[model samples]
Structures are given as C-alpha cells and as structure tokens.
Target: MNNHSMTRRLLIGLMTSITLIWLIATVMGLSVMEEEYDETFDSSLQETAERLVPLVVDDLFRKEEIVAPQQLQAARPDEEGEYLTYQVRDKTGKVLIHSHDAPPTPFPAPLQGGFWSDDTHRYYTATGVSNTIFVQVADAFANRREALSETGLALFLPIFALLPLGLALSWVITRRALAPVDDLGLEIEAKDSGNMELLKTDALPLELLPIAGSVNVLLQRLRNALEAEREFTANSAHELRTPIAGALAQTQLLINELGQGPGKRRAGQIETSLVKLNHLAEKLLQLSRAQAGVGVSEKPVDLIPVLRVLIDEFHHSGQDEDRLICRCAPNARLHGHYNADAFAIALRNLIENALIHGDPDAPVEVSLKADGSISVVNGGPVYTPDELAKLTGRFQRGHTTATGSGLGLSIATRFLEQMHATLTLASPASGRDDGFEAVVRFPHQD
Candidate 1:
C-alpha cells in the first residue's frame, strides 16, 4: 500500500485500541465505585438496624400491646437520616413497629445477615431478637447510582476530549517520521536520464538507508553501461572510417590507372562497395545520435515547400522522373523545426530503399499532409506483421531483397527518432495491389 494508506490504517488501529481501552477502564471504574458506594450504604444500614434492634426488642416482643404511633414516628427520623427504612416483626411475621414510609410488602424477606434486591436498587439487613422480635433495615440505591454515574462521566469525559488531540498528534508524528521518504521522492523527481547518479544516503532512516543505497548502486551501473555503449560506438566508427576512406581513395586511383574493359568493371564493383560502406557509416552515426536523444527546438515549417524541394532533388539526381510522384495536400504546413540535413537523409534513404526493392515499373509515391505526418508508398510484396516489426531494426532486410543494404530502414528509423518523431511500416490500407507504406509522424508545436 501507499504511505498515506498505510498511515491511515495505523492511525485507525491505534485510535480503536485507545477507544476500547478507555471504554473498558470507564466501565470498570464505574463498576468499582458503584460497588464501594453500595457497600458503604449497606454497612450504614446494617449498623443502624443492629443498634435499633436492642432498643426495639421489648416493643417488638410485646404482642399484647401495639407500639404507640408517636414512638414509631420518633424512630422514623433515624431511618430517614440514614436513608434507610425499618420494620419490626413478631415470630408470626406481623409488623409491630415500622417506619412511617415502610412499604406494604415488608421489604422483601431479608437474610439472617443481609441481602440485596434483585435489581440492586436496595440493600436489606435483619437481626432476630430471641427468635420473637425481628428488625429489618433497607437502604435505597439512589446515592450509589448517582456516584457511579459521576464516576463514569469522570472517566469518559477526558477520553472524548483527547480523541481529536490524539488524531492530530498521530498525523504530526507520522509526517515527521516519514519526512525522509518525502525528501527522497523530491530528489527522485529532480532526476532525469541525463543525471543518473547515486542518491545521497545521509538523512535516511537506518532501516531505509540500505534501500536508498541499492537504488544508487543500480543507477551507477546503468550510467556505466550507457557510457560503455557510447564509447564503443564512437571507437568503432572512428576505426572503420579510416579504412573505408582509404579503400575509396585507392579504388578511385585504380579507376584512373585502368581505362575501360575488365579493369573498369572491377573499379565499378569497388565503387559500389564504397557506396555501401559510406551508407553503413552514415547509418552508424545516425544510430548513435538517436541513442543520445538528439532533438531540435520546434518552430513552424512549411511542408509543401519541403516536399517540392525533395522531389526536385530526386529528379535532378537522375532517379527515374516518371517513376517518382509527389501528392502534396494544398497549403500543407507543419509546426516543428527539423534538422534539414537529417530530414533529407531520412527521406532519401526511404525513397532509395523503395526504388531498389520495389517493382521497377511501379511508381514510388510520397505524400505530405497538414497533420504533421508524411508517408512513402512503394509497390512491392507486403511484409507480414513479424517482418514489419523487424523492418526498422539494425541490418534487417526483407527476405526478397538480398542485394540491398539492410541499413536503409534502420537509418530512417534512427533519424526519425532523433527528430523526436515516430516511424511505422505497414502494408497499404488499399490492399496488396498498393504494396507497403512507411509512415513518419513528427511531434509538432502550436
């Protein structure tokens, strides 16, 4: 999960645990306070009853005369003062003396010592005097309930108040703890392919330092690999250029020395080889430039004029004029600056490839549209999906074209990439009769 999600889950878990603990503590505290209050009230009631038993023994045992109403009323004050109710009964269970407010049911049969009501709302105690006079005391639970409620409130109120404070503290603590991660993210955001370097390990937590170190190691390795590849390409191109140039110079000298005949034919062969070598060298340079991410700043450029120039150049170069065609969309313009040399090289390679591999009688058609794209269609056997996919790969030539240099499409692909464009090769949408088409799409600016 993301850091934010993980933090949220942790905060929720902590809060839940805290809430549960608070609830349990509150409940337990209330229970204990309630029990203590009930115990104190019950003890007071029992003591009052015990003390009254001795005084009321004679009155309770005297069955011949009833207790005077005034005497009963005088004892009622003690019962009321102690929050207790009392009743004095004979062996037959008839009440002889009772508090003024005593209930008709005689306070639910008390035990020999004491007993509690089923609902715990009252406590009752009794003492038997000579098995004839029994005195009972009952204490109401109003004060105990009030005390328990107050205790519960005391325990619960702080917890409720602290919940939001706890949440804010949790957020603050989490953010502080994760500060290194946020810093690392910002550092990574500032990085690009051109600046592949080891990230600094300082300021990272001990547990995460190893991860940051590993990432830095990976970046270092990648930088080394790219540097090695670039060096190799540069060295190989330098080494090959010297020999190719020497061979071309020697071939020109030999052509001058031998006039016509078999010598001339051999010289022509050498010239063809030189041309292929030059093409290969140029392609290598293009590939290297593409790998280095070369691109030009974009600006408005007119496509119609560019296409016309390319067409005129092709005609002037002795390419069959009748076999070449241009279909320009009227007033077609594109909003991107391209390296004119690179653009011409890419277009020439595509057209030359089509001319050499395509059916000689069929016209090679080039088209440009206002949508910042160009297409070159040639008449030839259409390639399958697999072949089309490999068409732009280095030194890849179709099965039918054995005499041709396989670098043509690769050079075009590299040039397009360097120009910040895309190249696609596919069979003509009009079916096999129109053969294959190579499409290039340029990144345009407004």
Candidate 2:
C-alpha cells in the first residue's frame, strides 16, 4: 500500500504544526525566564551590598586598627561554597573584611558605589562612612546559567512526551472524520450495469452530499441509455427472426427446384447468405439479453451439468466427436450463483469459436479444474497481444477469414461480467507452443 494516504498526510501535517508551535512557545518562554533571572539576581546583588555596608562600617570602627584582610567565618562550617561572595575595602581599594568564601584579595570592582561585572561574576559596590568604606557583593555567572539550564530542560521534557500522544489522538480524529468519504467511494465503486441503485446519502457529511448527488445522476443516465439500447436490439432481433427463417426455408426449396443449373448455384449462394443472416440475428438476441443483465442469480447453481449439456449438443450438431475432448479434475465442483442459461450461452460461444477458428487437423480441448475454473484450448496460429485485445470487441474479426458474426466474444464477455466472473484470453495455450486459450474464472465463495 502507498504511504501517501490522506489520513497519514493529515496526521503528519497537524502534528508537525502543533510540535512547531510548542517549540516556538517554549523558546519564547525560556527567553523571558532568562531575562527575569538576570533582573532578580542583579537586585539580590545590589541589596546584599547595600545592607552589608553599614554592618561592615560598624564592625571596622570597633576594630580600633586594621592590619590585614579578615575572613569572616560562618557561624557553622560551610561545606558548599557560597553563591554570593563579598569584600569590604577602604577608599584606596585595600580589603579590610570579607565573607568566608571570598578570595583573600581586593575585589576587581572599583572602590565606588555602583554596579559592575567581570568574566566570572556580577558585582555591586556600596560606599559608606563618607566614602571611606567600600563593600562589594559578587554573584557567580555559573550559578545564574545553571538555574536557566535546569529551567529550559524542565520546559523541553513535556514536548517529547506530549507529541506522540497528540499524534495518536489526531489519527483517531482524522479517521473518524474521513470515514464517510471512504464509505461513499466504496458505494460508487460497487455500482455497475447489473446494479445501478441510487447512492444512499442520508449519513453523508454536507461536503460530500454534492458529490453523491452528481454520481447518482450519472448512474441514472447510464442506466436509461443501456436500457434503451438493449430494448431496441432485442425488439429488432425478435421481429426479424420469423421473416428471416421463412425466407431461408423458401430459398432452400427454390434451390432444390432449380437443380443442376446456374439458377441453382445462385440459389445456393442465397441460402448461404440467409443462413449467415439468421445466425447474426440469433447472436444479436443473445447479446441483447446479456446486456440486459441476465447472468446474475440469487442462489448457488451447479454449472458442471450445463457444460456437459453443451458438449453433447455440439457432438450432435455435426461437429466431429473425435475432434472435441473434455476433461474434469477428480471431485471438482463447479457451483456459483449465476444464471445457467447465461453460462451456457458464454460457454457455447467459446466452444463454437474454437471449432470454427482452430486448425482443422487439431482437436479442441475443454477442461474443468479443481478450483471450478473452465478452460477452452484449441490448436491454432498464435495471436499477438494487440490482436487478442481486439478479438473481444463487437464486429472485430482480427485477421480471421472464418465465417462468423464476431459478436460471440463480446456477448460472452458481457454476460460473464454480469455474473461477476472473469473471462481471460491468452495465446500459446498452456503447455502448447502455438494455440489460443480462454478461461472462465468464477469468484470464490466463502
């Protein structure tokens, strides 16, 4: 099956749009979160510096004198390094006091009151005691980056889990929405010459109602046209049969009366022409009936007896019994819900065609297979693909010089189709180098 189904396409398109939207929203949210983190960290940095300025000044005033930078130990031993480090310095930038995690050096920030930053940390400096004391608080860049990275990952994990769920739900919804379209297609496909019932559109969506209406109109028109054609052909053949038969009988009597003269020969020719006309008219009647859908039945019918009867009729109708052969597989069953008369008509045509067109020196072979298919093979000149294709058309003789109306195959094909059986033609009959073969395959029953 093709992977380009509409359901699959819709599902992919919808899911792709949804996933892209989600990703775009996530990116926007992460950007905003990063901006907010910057402001919050900066505010904390400034607040810590200002708040510690007064405390550092008071502690230094009680020191009496400052010898070296003092590292202020926490109340308890701190295992993790401090996220915020600070240093208290003088106007000349000499460090006087610092937090536990602060480096034993003056901070890189200038000894003034404002915000500044370097590669590793953001710094905020606060001046107190008439600009004599300076306090700077440092916030690590890595800490802010870690917080943003964790937050971005938290926002991304849901997308992976939700995308598949979203696609599955979309699939169910899509299939349900397109169900009516599928049903409509199947209904249209089922219509044929034998079944032209109107489409049922009661359950169809509003969008599909117009399509169904158009199809119904088309089917109605076709049904009417076919009915008219079949009626005309049938009536013409029925009306011609009686007159043609009387004329042919009179011609035969006249040929007998004008014995051994040029008139007799001319009468013979007329007789032959009359016989051909009668055959043509009979074929037309059969064709009309086939077109009228006379091949379908409502119950299983045993078709093997029909085949045997046709063979017997051919044997009694001046065909050489020795030149016709029949075979059947052991325990083969030929049962199908098709009209027996129609099957007989199609099979007889195949047999007659084979006898008339086949090589006079070779025999015609008929066989019924174990699977219920019937094959008719006769030794003859092999036909090309193009020639075989045209042989089934009405009035198409395909290079044969034989006497025939050329409607045999056409009628057979039409009747078989109405019966839901298929007739396949092939040259170079199975197991033979040069011949033609026709096979009738019935649909398998459950």
Candidate 3:
C-alpha cells in the first residue's frame, strides 16, 4: 500500500528466500557427504574382513600350531586397511582362538554365513575352516561414529565460512537495488509547494517504472488541482473587488447628497461595511501575492539604518500619543533579496499593531542588535500558544476587538518568509506577564 510497507515486504521476502536456499543447500551437501563417508567406511570394513579370512581360517584348522598373537597383530595391513578383531569357534560356540583386545560383549548370534548388526559393535562375517570350526571377523561401532563426525565437520566448515560472505553480499545487493528509491526520496524532498512538478521515471528499472510513472501522474494531478484552486480564488477576488468598490462609491455619493440625519447614519453604516470589505479584499490580494512568491530582490542592505528609518517614520505617523523607543547598533547589514518598500510595510504593520494593542502611555520598544536580529516588544495582553500560532493566519484578530484590520501580522509574516527570514513570537519570561515580544532574524551579509 505504502512505500514503507512495500519495501519491508520486499526485504523480508528476499531474506527468507535466501535463508531457505542456503539451508537446503547446506543440508543437501551434508547429506551427500555423510552418505559418501558411510559407503567408504563400509567398503573398507568389508575389504578388511576378506583379507583376514585366510589367516583366521588357517589358524582355526591348525589347532595345535603355536602362533604368536602379538606377531600377527603387529603385521601392517596392505591395500585394505583394517581395524578389526577375529574369533575362531567350534560348532558348540566354544572359543578356540581369539584376537587380543576384543570387547567383552558377546558377538551377535551366528547367521547363515555373514550378517552385520549396526546396533551392536560388530560386523560378523563367518567362514567355515572345516565342518566343525568357523571363523568370524568383527569391527567396532566407535570407528563409524568417529568417521561420520569428521565427515560432518568437513561438510559444515565451508557453510560456516560462507554465511558472513552471504550476509555481506546481501547488504551490497540491497543497497544497490534500493538506490532508485533513495533517489526518488531525495527528488521529492527537493520539491516544495511552489514547485510541485511531475517527477521523471526514465531512470527507473523496468520493474519499478510503473510505480514511478503513477507517482508522477499523481503529482501532476495535484499540481493541476492546486493551480486551479488558486486561479479561482484570485479571479473571484478580482471580480468582487470592482463591484464592492462601485457600491462603496455610490454610498459615498449618497452620503454627500443627503445632509446629516437617519439617512447619514445609515450611509455611515454602509461606509463601515465597505471599509471592512476593502480590508478583506486587500488581505486577499496580499495573501495571493505571498503565495505567488512575489516581492523579493536580492541585494546587500544595511538593517540598522532600515530599523532606525522605520522607527522614525512610525513615531511621526499619527502616533504621538504613544512613546516609541528605538535602539539599534551601528552598521548591521544582511545579505538577501531586500525590497525596501516591502520591509518598510512589514515593519510599520508590526509597530502599528504593537502601538494599538499595547499600553498607550508605556513605551513600544523596538531593538535591533549587531547580529542582524531585531525585536519589537510591547506591553499588552500576551496571546496563548494556540492564539500565537494562528496570529500569522489571514484575517486573524488578537484577543481584543480592535478597529484595525487583522491582516497586519499575516502580511509581515509572509513578507519575512519571502525574504528568507524567520519570525518568532514569545511571551515575557515571567510566564504570565502581560507583554509579547516579536523577534525577526536576518542572515548576516557576506
């Protein structure tokens, strides 16, 4: 369903398959090796039995012959190696001759001629030396187990060595095979709302091409939908502005024609409504321009002088009732697309909002530091965290029903965003202090 799910499933499937295949191969190889070892050991046992038959038969017939058991035991085996023991017995099962170091356990009951017992520690091959004498050769079970264990180790050693190599190879293959997915993620990350274009699928493998194509198609559809919505809002706002302007003009004309009365009061109400509508229209225009990424012209600009000029202008602009305190360090400059007009507009909006909402008699302090940072602090009822979050939204008013339009903070925020700057709002450190501070940071000019 999602890329994470798909990737997880693919990785699990590959790991499972590799594990199963490796296990099967290891098991099969071990089994073959075990079988070969069993066959070779059995063959050697049979060959040893055959070679010992003559010596055992001769010794059984010559019952009185003085044969040295130690000399026979010391004799080295020829082509057929032997680790064996023998016993010659009468028809009544009485031992006539026996090899040294034979087990105390009784040999298996005699068969027709020869028989092997895997559970017992013996392979009995009986040969009649005469009508009354029979000879038997036997080997031990310990030898078989030893051989099998050795063979198992031989088979398992390579597999143990290969496991690390397999894991390493899996890692390499996984990284290489999933490289396209990583690239796709990077490509998506490089995009933003302003540049939501369809991604190309040409570089993807055949197996992944369809997925990439679908993603690109979805991106295209989303881009188209967003563009259509923006166009509709912009066009509708433009169309309504003219009609609202005309109605306001007519109302003004009527107000002029009729002297002060109930008619003048009604006209005043209409004019107030027109002013609110105009404010809304202006906010809409500002929001549209902000979304369109307008009003940026890159150049080095002295921020200290800009802050001083704005404070001076605000002090002169119909706010003599309020004290404006300005503090700025000398020669602080920032590197960015600096639109002097936009900067002035944004700064004025912040200062005006502070002056209106803050205490009229108290100072509205504006401070600019040498690090290209500016802070505007005002004594006012601080907004809650949620309220502060919404302060940058269009048409959002603060706690009080101030007569001014609510687009001031939103416009400043948008302008700062376009200038590659950051704006932060915080309450005074006492936690419940009835004052708010707005800080703006501009990158230092190179």
Candidate 4:
C-alpha cells in the first residue's frame, strides 16, 4: 500500500532531485574552493622562497662557516608552522643551512629552479647571489589537504542541517497540491446508479480536467440510456393495460350470456386467463419501477404511521382488516432513513404473502422493533430448505395452490437490497410445523 501511493512517489522524487542537485553543487563548490586555496598557498610558497634568496646570499656567498641549524630563526618544529620546511644549497648541490625539521638533502633536482614537486611536497626554488646559492621552500601536501578538509566541513555543515527541512517542506507541498484529487476519488465512490447527476470537472486543476470531463461524459450517456429503458417499460405497460382490461371485461360479459354450457365454461377460462395477464402486466410495471427508481427522503420515516396507513388501505381495498395485526415496540419510535417508497413495497409484499397463503382463521402477525426490525409471521405452509433457497427468484412460488404473479417476494427482495436492507424467509418461525415468516432488517447508521 505504501509503495502504491502517488503522493509518496511524488515526495520521494522531489526530495531525491533536491539531494542530487545539492550533491552535484557541493562537489563543484568543493573542487573550486580546493583550486583557489591551492593557488593562494602556492603563491605564498613562492614569496617565502623569494624572501629567502637575499638572506641565503648574504650568509652563504661569504667565506663563512655554515650557520648552525638552530640559528635559522624559523618557528620551532613542534609548532603548527612546521608545515614549512626550507633547505639552502650551494652550486654543487650541497646542503648548507636548513630548518631543524628539514632533511639534509636538496629539496628538488639539483640546479632545478622555480617550482617543482616530488611524491609528497610542493617546492619552490630561488637562486641567490649570482645564482651560486639557492634557497628552496617546501610544504607537505597532506598539510594542505588537512586545511582544505576543515574548510569543506565548514561549508557542508549547513547543507546537512537544511536537508531535512527541505524534505519536510516538499512533503507538505505535495500533499496539499494533490488533496483535490483525493477528494474527487471519494466523491466518485459515493455515487450510485440512483444518482444521474454528472460529475463536475470545472473546479479541478487543469491537468486533471480532461479525465474528469471524460468520466462525466460517460456518466451522462449512462443516465440517458437508463432513462430511455425506464420510459419504454412504463409506456409498454400503460399501452397493454387498456386492451387487456377490455378483453377481460368482454370475456366476463360473454360468460354471463352463455351460461350453463361448454361455451360459458370456455369463456370463464378465457376470463381467468385475461385476469392473470392483467395481473402480470401490473406486476411487471411494479418490478420495472422498483428496479429503475430509488427514494431518498430528508426526514426519517416513522414506521408506526407508515404501517397504520398500509393497514387502513388494505382494509379499504376489501382485505380483512381483523386478519392483520401490527405491534410496535412500547414507548419507542421506529424511525428509518431508508427510501420510504421502497420500504412500503417490501412491507406490503410481506403482508400480502402472509394473508394470501396463511390459514384464513389465523391472524397474521406484524411486528416493529425499536431497533428498526420488521417481521411478518403467518400460519402458512412450512418450506423445505431447497424451496427457501429458490424462493426469491422470479415466478417462483412457495405454494402451488396460491394464485399470485410470484414476483412479489423477488421485487421486495430487490428493493430491500437497494436500501441496504435484507428479507429472509423462515419456515415455521415458532419452530412448529405450520408457519412461515418474512423478516426485514434495515441497515443501521451511527
């Protein structure tokens, strides 16, 4: 997961570039500083050699004993200035006067003048007093490097301090710059098929605009296509209703006129067929609506009121009111935020199934808990596990004797799923051999 993060990669790339560039600059700076220091020190060495020219000429050109090494008047060898080692030689290349730390040998090739070097030292030679005598000044290369190393440490110390600060600043800037993209991802994840609105791209950065725009275009196409499909289903059901109802009415009239004969019996059969067709048409419309639409209400739905309304409607519509009973949890409100229309469909299906298939003498049980759980129990036929497994499928029926479109439970199941709720069928809910139960549990929110 860490390796897959784009922000991590961006931060790492930026910091790496800063570090690489700094390293390159540091190396270049160190090189330039080293060259400059070498020039300054080499010039100082030449000056020291030139200054010794006259001094060596005054002492060595005269017929005088060689000055003792202690009398050279240079800084003591124990001091830091011991880096400078000087030797004075005659024309024959014989060492005469030398610093206490200097080796008793010519610093460079015999008779070699100006500046020269060996494996370890930089030497500058100057002729003194008619070129008969020479003074050579030498400095160790290691001493020059030690001084330069200190200078380089001083320059690099600040860079080490700033590196962490620079990396931290880059991370903060990178995260802020990409925050909009993360917000866009969350917004997309929240969108569902129920939402037909286009994704807005105008507020995004220029680099991301095209991607968001392309996604919006695709969503627009999907919305248009879904709208067309829903329109077709509705229009077809409407168009089929009038002809189917008219045919059903004509068959009934013909059955009445041709009473007490085979013709009347055939007409009666036709009437039954027409009624079934009408019922199927209505079910298809309901299924289409259930599949195509989603409901989102701002206020919570009060289930007690909702159930009362459904029960009253059921009674007014010629169903036995006393056969259905609704029980709510005492002293508590059953409020749910899921789509009310969808909830109505599911609850209505459960109650209808219970009333249609249960023993006519036994009352159907309806329960609503404070936890937002609803259940419908009836003295219907017990179901085998196999039948329960296939129960929610289209046109699948639990009882062969019951007359229904067989789409009620399937439609209810589909709608409930859209609301993140579930419907389960239990055979003999009381552990007896004679009842069936349908329980609906709505998703909970914190």
lDDT tens digits, residues 246-319, model 4?
A: 99988888877886988988888898888888877887787787767564466777666777788788878877
My TM-score estimates for the predictions, one after another, are 0.62, 0.89, 0.78, 0.74
Pairs in clash, predicted candidate 1: none
lDDT of 2 at 143: 99
- Residues 1-446 of candidate 2 have per-residue lDDT tens digits of 65578898888889889888988998999899999999999999999989998788788888887876888767346588888999988888888888898987888988878899999999999999899888999999999999999998898888899888888889889999999999999999998877888999899999999999999999999999988988999999999999999999999989778869889998999999989999999999999988878897899899899899999998888866778899999878888788999999999999989988888789999999988899999988999999999999998885567899999999999999988889999998989899999999988743
Query: Which should have the higher lDDT, number 1 or number 4?
Result: 4
Q: Which candidate is the best by TM-score?
A: 2
Clashes of 2: 0
Better of 2 and 3 by TM-score: 2
Worst ten-residue run, lDDT, model 3? 66-75
The C-alpha lDDT values of all candidates are 0.73, 0.89, 0.70, 0.79
Runs of candidate 1 with Cα error greater than 4 angstroms are 1-122, 126-213, 252-271, 298-312, 320-322, 337-353, 402-420, 430-434, 443-445
The list of candidate 2 runs beyond 4 A from truth reads 1-4, 61-67, 74-81, 118-120, 444-446
**lDDT of candidate 3 over 1-446, digit per residue (tens):** 64565555666677678667867887787778667866776676666666766776775456666443222443344544446776655666655565655433335647335657667555655555544655566766677767667866776676678767866677778878888988987887766545677787778788777777887887888778877767776787798799999999999999999997999999989999997887677656655655555547766554456666777777678755357888776665554667776677677778877887776666778877777777888877767899889988877887665577788888888778777788898866134467878888876655
**Higher-scoring candidate on lDDT, 1 or 3:** 1
- Stretches off by above 4 angstroms in model 3 are 1-13, 57-71, 74-83, 88-100, 104-106, 109-112, 126-135, 154-165, 232-264, 295-316, 319-323, 337-349, 411-420, 429-432, 442-446
Ranking by lDDT: 2, 4, 1, 3
